[model samples]
Target: MSEKQYLLDKTLETWKGKRVALAVSSEHSFTGIIEDFDEEVILLRDVVDIAGNKAKALIVKIDDLNWIMLL
Candidate 1:
């Protein structure tokens, strides 16, 4: 893997099962605990959607993410 992917993988490893928020767009973001992930995507559980409502879960492509931060 590239250094970029390696770093991201490391970051995700630390954040796994931790509450986090990832933005897909300026107006779109989701909050949840990281349930699983790979180089391509992340699975978030007990999620709160951009609309601020409960969601069963969210699966986000890594390339589509604007940012991710601890919540």
Candidate 2:
């Protein structure tokens, strides 16, 4: 895997079940506990919208992600 992919893999592995926020290029963000991830996407549980309201879940494409922040 490339460096970026390695970093992502490490992040997913180390932060599993921890709350995090993903920022996208569209300026939208999703916050949730990491549920799972694959090559193309990530599964988030107990998600919250950008406005901070709770959501059941969120599936976000990996390519759309700009950054990840631990919360």
Candidate 3:
């Protein structure tokens, strides 16, 4: 695996079952408990969004992510 992939895998391991917020773009962000992930996307459960509403789940593309904050 590439170095970036290695680090992403490691970070994913730590993020599992933890509350995290992903910055996708200047206007979009997703916050929730990390449920699962693959090479392409992340599945989040019980997402707490910016508008302060709760969502059952959220799927975010990895390539779209700018940053992730553990909350």
Candidate 4:
């Protein structure tokens, strides 16, 4: 598979039943439990420090994300 596809697959594989620290563009950060994911983005809960205060509903696109550190 292509590298991008591989990375996305890895992200999804690592996301299951795990917490992650998502570093996005604009120097924003998000730490939460990954609820679900797709090829383009991820669904996160307990989101904070992005759009506003802490929120349980958030969708972070993969292109906007710089990195994801599995925790």
Candidate 5:
């Protein structure tokens, strides 16, 4: 794999099962426990989102994220 992808995967592996907040854009975001991930998307459990949204499970695209903060 590419170095960038390797680093990303390593970071994600370390952060799995931890709580995180992901910013999709200036107007949207989600907070949850990182459940799992593959090459394409991440699975979030117990998701509670900004903008009055919530879900038991969320599958979000990796490319759609602006930033992630550990919580």
Candidate 6:
């Protein structure tokens, strides 16, 4: 696997079955369970909030991820 893929795999493995904070464009933030992950993106479900309201979100392309915090 490529270095990027390896890193993504490692990150996913480390963060699996955990909640993470996602920061998207427009400074939107959401907390959700990490349902699944791939080289390109992470699938999050059971979204709790976005900026301040209940919402569901799909984060595409790990490169677009500004940051992820396990909690």
Alpha-carbon local distance difference test for all models: 0.91, 0.89, 0.90, 0.81, 0.88, 0.77
39 Cα displacement, candidate 4 (Å): 1.0
What is the C-alpha lDDT profile of model 4 across 9-64, one tens digit per residue? 88677777677888889598888888888788888887776566788767988889
lDDT of 6 by residue, 1-71 (tens): 99978886988888887888877653667788898887778888777766466657566567777777887
Off by over 4 Å in 1: none
| lDDT accuracy of residue 30 in candidate 1 | 87
User: Could you give the candidate ranking by TM-score, starting with the highest?
Assistant: 3, 1, 5, 2, 4, 6
| Residues forming the 10-long window of minimal summed lDDT in candidate 5 | 22-31
Q: Count the backbone clashes (under 3 Å) in each candidate.
A: 0, 0, 0, 0, 0, 0
Estimate candidate 1's alpha-carbon lDDT, on a 0 to 1 scale.
Answer: 0.91
User: Which candidate leads the pack in lDDT?
Assistant: 1
**Cα lDDT tens digits for candidate 5, 1-71:** 88987987899999999999998756679899999998789899999988668789999888888898889
Q: Tell me the tens digit of each residue's lDDT in model 2 across 1-71.
A: 89989988997989889999888777888899999998899899999887889888888999999988888
Lowest summed-lDDT stretch of 10 residues in model 6? 51-60
- What TM-score does model 1 achieve against the real structure? 0.91
Model 3 weakest 10-residue run by lDDT: 21-30
- Sum up the clashes in candidate 2: 0
Please write out the lDDT profile of model 3 over residues 6-70, one tens digit for every residue: 89989998989999988886678779999999989999999987889999999998898999989
Best prediction by TM-score: 3
Residue pairs in steric clash, candidate 5? none
lDDT of 1 by residue, 1-71 (tens): 99999999999999998999889856688899999999889999999977889988889988899999987
